[model samples]
Target chain A: MAEHPSSPIPGEKPRWLDQPRNVTKVVWALVAVCALLFLSDVLYEKHPTFAVEYLFGFYAIYGFIGSVGLVLAAKWMRTILMREEDYYDRDR
Target chain B: MTAIAELAMPISPGLIVILGGLLVPFLTAGIARVYVLLLSAATLVYVLGLPSGEHAAFTFMDLDLQLLRVDKLSTIFGTIFLIALFLGNLYAWHERDRMQRTAAQIYAGSAIAAAYVGDLVSLFVFWELTAIASVFLIWAAGTDRSFRAGMRYLIIQVGSGVILLAGVLFHVHETGSITFGHIGLGSIGGTLILLAFGIKCAFPLLHNWLQDSYPEATVTGTVILSAFTTKLAVYALARSYAGTEMLIWIGATMTAFPIFYAVIENDLRRVLAYSLNNQLGFMVVGVGIGTELALNGTAAHAFSHILYKALLFMSIGAVLFRTGTCKGSELGGLYKTMPWTTGFCIVGAASISAFPLFSGFISKSMILSAAGEEGHFITWAILLFASAGVFHHSGIKVPFFAFFAHDSGRRPKEAPWNMLLAMAVTAGLCIGIGIWPEPLYAMLPFPVDYVPYTAVHVITQLQLLLFAALAFTFLMRTGLYPPELRSTNLDIDWIYRRALPAIIRGLGSGIGVVWDSLIGGGRMLVSATIDGAARNFGPYGLIGRTVRVGNGVAWVATLLLVTLLIAYSAG
Candidate 1:
């Protein structure tokens, strides 16, 4: 077996950051930038006060509820629709 | 202009192009290739120069046949279809197979014809034409698997056309009109049309033919097959029925279901096939939402998808062409030798992933925003999850495994210049549309005011991406990632592949036993009748006994004398 690259430092166990450390850092940085930009748009963007209030309220409640419902529906479908990975194979 | 009109109005020219497709098989390979390309190119020019907002209907022998109508929506789809044909033709120019070339031309012609069709009858005719022409591409592989795949594809596709025909008949009976236009899905006829479109869209359960047949087609054949059929169905659905609440759920399922199959699929081309299904799901969702922005998104997504998806397929085809295999297990470290092909594949991957500054991001975001605008927070969120799933399969998985994973030590030569040229042109479109979407948006059937470059949209999409990427990394680091190997992944196609065939075989045998018993009983009855006849008619029978008649004669005479006396007294 090939030796692991970027092994854990002495007394410091490598977690998600152990391998491809620079790549992980870049990904996280991009994420942070996205979050900051989103917050700025939500708070500072120009809009009618009433419209903003209603839209954001809808986004919060409906988005969360809908996501949960989707997760549940997906789980239910997994039972009925899901099949063995090799379902189409002749040999299987 | 008046003098031009005075001259005999020439035939639609589109018909000529379609008819030319039929003659391709008789031509030599070199001539056929040039003829097919020139015909398609000319058709593209004809469709482009077609006058906008003009609707024409022709009747023959009192049949009132309406063909070749042009509108904004038809123009957009028709134009893109022509471009697709052009690219598909260029990609397949190296293929000397006569059947493939003929099928490709006919497929393009039928799609263009379908777009221009003015009435339901004309639409159905061209719709079935597209189906008939496309199946040859699948069969062109000349393999047992492809034959079976093509057969299933024919059944589902022809089934769709039949359903559409039934719907058209019902629709005409109910509405007393055969003109194709928006009709809500509240009646049986409307519902049937929706189902027909659903089959073509490869919606959820009806989606198996796409994944099953596409990968089984020849390399260039797959590229041509990718362009027309499903997208045409999307256009049809969006045209006739939109905002059907069920489509929302159906579309979401379509988007999400294929990722798992794609992740585990052994064949790279099959993976792309599944990915194609997943992308169609997004377009379906857009149609389901039925807002101006959403509809635009659907059209734009279809446009961009044809580019990048074709690019991806072409790259994989190049790999297959070089190595004679597209199984991921047999391919890795190819990037070291074929850097150009690898780079093109990555561009396709990034575009599909909706990475920042890609075509997918620009178009897909429109639908997401439309969902949010419509107060469909749940639908929007599911779409978000699907976005992440896209990253997992088409975006990351395709590139990572094919290019970087474990280096399987293969040194295949790069794709041919013609193939690379096809990929490059497609890649250029992907980037061009991503950077300047104005031209694409302008071509949409609806007016567009929504900006794609909004701070909120970009930022949220990025956050979703980052988290999804992080999830992927987390899975990999923890050894939870699904390993890439030569394993078959199952989808809805299994119903036809396994269950349906087994049922048919079982039914066949059961019928055979019943038939044997009926035949046995029938033989027994016939033989018994023949035996009885033989016994009565043979020389040993009572009717042939001449000596018995001589012995009875004397007794009869004695009895007759007494009877005659009694009869005389009665008289």
Candidate 2:
């Protein structure tokens, strides 16, 4: 993960990140980590603050849904709230 | 040091900083910078040396005023404010604008002053001082837009102070006590005070001014601006309204709604502003929980939040400084060039997102635990959701689109060395507090009993945050993620900025029409009277002609006869 100084040579080869295969590999790595964390939930001692916490993979599900819901809801909001960058200035 | 501290006994540290700020304009730019830094450091040293008791007491018109109330709560807030003042000055070292330098010092000093003041009257004075002094930061941007935004910001800020003053007047009249303490929501005075605090805390609909003005400030100005105003309000609220039940729901709403706006916000600084509001919600909820642990959580969170939040603003400010744009649509792949800034930004992001070993984890979880322990199930659920949402926008979205997403073909120079040093020191604090929270916890208003590094806590927090990241990846890969665009997404400020003005214009024209008709009718009546008079008394008419001799004689005779008759009757 060492980062080199960003002095670019002319016509240098693209870095590992520029490769599609490496990109796919990184995505898979993230997926694997997420899966492992979700599975490791069974190893912990139960200390439920609420009944809902006892559900299997509850945090994972809630987090995914909450984030998705936020994005989707915000996208819909753009329909009503979005305006030209100069919207405030137009009247003035 | 003790001698110096004793000599400075009666003068509040805040006043020292204010006096120093006033002297900034007289000094040369380079000297001013060093002088402010030294002044802040000296204030910190003096504040640290003092004991936990009231100092600088005086009577103002028969009411006791304590300018320096040194206790665990005020001490912690004061320490952090001075630290932020030093860090902010360091970050803006290259700034030559006298107004910004002076305003920043005065603003930070007033906030520290607000925190340490022992009574509502003194708090009101410092509170309004913070507002009046800070607006110059916004105006220092010197854009037409910044000017107008600063005006709006000033109005709302000063308006909050006005409300606080009104509340203080009412509370004093009713209770005959000006002491700032747990006023609770038992009376109208307390409610008005809470409203005032709510406005500054950016409670839900009362927020927009924060978002409207912060992004419009100068790069260094925004960094300085972010540290003081709202957090001072949070401190005030914790002092006054602890245990107020309504704040629980208010806090939850404050936490939940801003993430939605932040999700699609194109301006990175504005996104940070929304995130700032969300963080305040956590502190507010802790204040509402009202246990010793909860208040400690609030103080701890405020201390940590000021650093990390400033760190975030500093990073974006650096980007805006170098590239001249902080828009998500305009920035990406900055890590290739600005490695240090990118690393520091990630640290800030991690701290704010409450990663297991970051500042936010140790602080925010205390509030969440308080909610759960209090058996507020629904609020706990909403807070957890907000936690995941915060991770999504501030933690991931901010750094991703700015540094790692699409390459923007922008190869700007790295941030200035002073900015890097400021951010580096701030980032170090974020990590340091995360690793050893004991020093921070020790300074809290109460003893701490919570452990943030529990196995269950770490696992659950990771699951929540990582899953949110997974969701982001999915959206990006599927092309479902909304693209950043150059546009304005309206918020509550729309009412004041757009709708209210439009309504006023409509009413004005309506009134104008009525006024025009009324004036026309009056004009016509006057003209009719003049015309009739001309017709009756024209030169050729009977009264105007020379034959008026007999008429005049008759008139005089009648007048005399009438007078004679009246006199006779009276006699």
Candidate 3:
């Protein structure tokens, strides 16, 4: 949001979030969380209500794969669904 | 206190809002907020005082109508509706449009009426009223597109009401009862009623209306609209036709399909709209399960869903107001300027994605766990898959693209304090419910015995979310995520929006061509007939021959004489 007319903060103060380096920093933090969650999976008391719940890091793997699959599937769908923004009102 | 005690006895809580709404516009803007707040407060107080049984009934023609029902079920829904109305009105206090506030009141009133009704006729009446009143929200956008969307939204909403009315007629005729209660889809009437609820519940194919219309609404309008409509349908389904097994599949399908649509959708508001549908799927599954625990789960889920979804809509609405756009393609790195909005949005995102110590985790797990308990193994699996899918689009994609993605070079100002206050209140509820769900659990229609904070459950939930984040990171780093493009993605509304209109236009043109040829053909035929008549009877033709008058008279006389002569001879 660097270009809004309201946002030309005179002498724009530097913030931690604005630094591009923070992207890498956040990525590493996310990875560490994932790793810790994955490792801690074994120690948790297992209440496998469904057979699938018994699998190690099932939710983690499921989430990652499901998400990747969703994006890919949507990209494929865009071939059919994507149209000009004025698709419905082209005649207007 | 005595006056309120007397007032409570005379009417249903719903009418206070509907009637008060009529009087709201008379008040000056300065005290209008106080007036409206007190009105809602009175409604809540009245609802609290109403006995937990059918209270208000009257006869219309020969039909007995129960306008108010206050059981545990209605009580829970009523409480939430009042809560939502109060918060929604507070959020909209700064809005200048008098008509919109009036409409919002009517909308909330009708929803409360729908929740509290004890008979099919009353239900049907209030059902249509909600549809009619709430379309104003869509129209409040005051854009041509919103006008059209509001119109379509109204038609479908009314169609559901009509279907329900027809079903009620048949059901009453067959059973000799007008009570709104359990009936499976075993007869024509039952199936029709089921279809009605299905449409409103937005089961799969009938679901596109939610996505198409809600994003087109005015900012606060969308927040209010999000709370009542679908959740009302869920309540109706729970009231009348719980445990209908087909809802299992309908609910499952609802959960699964929207994530893909959400992924490619460019409007961040529309993405939340899809996310709303996905969350409804969870409630639908619970109603389908129909166990006491499941029904309680549905109620609790709806309660939290309303707050969090409204929170999401508020955050997005604030962005739209500040920057005049919510397109994913047009937004990024907003947190640099609008930090409060960004934080509240992430809270909303986290709640919807079922992060631990957030709202969705507590309510959604009950449904999933209940499905496993009931041996609906396959339904369980699909829902499990959909949970991850929900986290992907709603949790990661919404916040990531709007606040944290590559800078789109926009730095809009922070949302107004009122907007942030609204978001903060809702966000607080989301976390409060997550941290201590007992207050929410105690209010459920059925005793909610399920615990959401089991060690295994929290771990699994976190795993699901964090891994989804990893996948998002991977997609972003690899450039595999679909770039936000300014494009419209067609959905089922294409039937009415494009396909049918195109056909009508084709027919219109075809009819025009045929009409032109028919006019030409008729002219030729007319000319031919006129030419022949000219030769036979016109002044320029045989009649114009010399001595025509005398000769024609003589010819007629001779023919008459010949006929007489022949008759005499024959005799």
| DockQ leader | 3
TM per prediction: 0.81, 0.92, 0.92
Runs with alpha carbons beyond 4 Å of true place in candidate 3: A1-11, B1-10, B535-571
Instruction: Report the candidate with higher lDDT, 2 versus 3.
Output: 2
Residue pairs of candidate 1 with colliding backbone atoms: A66-B378
Docking class of 3: medium
lDDT of 3 by residue, B1-571 (tens): 7754553445777778888988878877767777777898789988888777666677779888777777888888998899889888878878878778889999999999888878888888889999999999899899999999999999999999999989988888788888888877888788889899888889888998899999999999999999998999999888877897788888888898998899999999999999899889989899889998888888989999998899888988999999999999888878988999999999998888888999989999899888988999888888888888888888878887888676666788999887888888889999999899998899888876788887888888888878988988888877787889999999999988999999999999999999999999999999999898888787667755456678889988999999999999999
lDDT of 1 by residue, A15-58 (tens): 33235655457556755754564354455354321243335333
lDDT of each: 0.77, 0.91, 0.86
Give fnat, all candidates.
Answer: 0.08, 0.70, 0.80
Output the number of the lDDT-best candidate. Answer: 2
Q: Which ten residues in a row have the lowest lDDT in candidate 1 chain B?
A: B4-13
lDDT score at residue B113, model 3, on the 0-100 scale: 84
B500-538 per-residue lDDT for model 1 (tens digits): 989999999999999999999999999998787667766
* Model 2 residue pairs with clashes: none
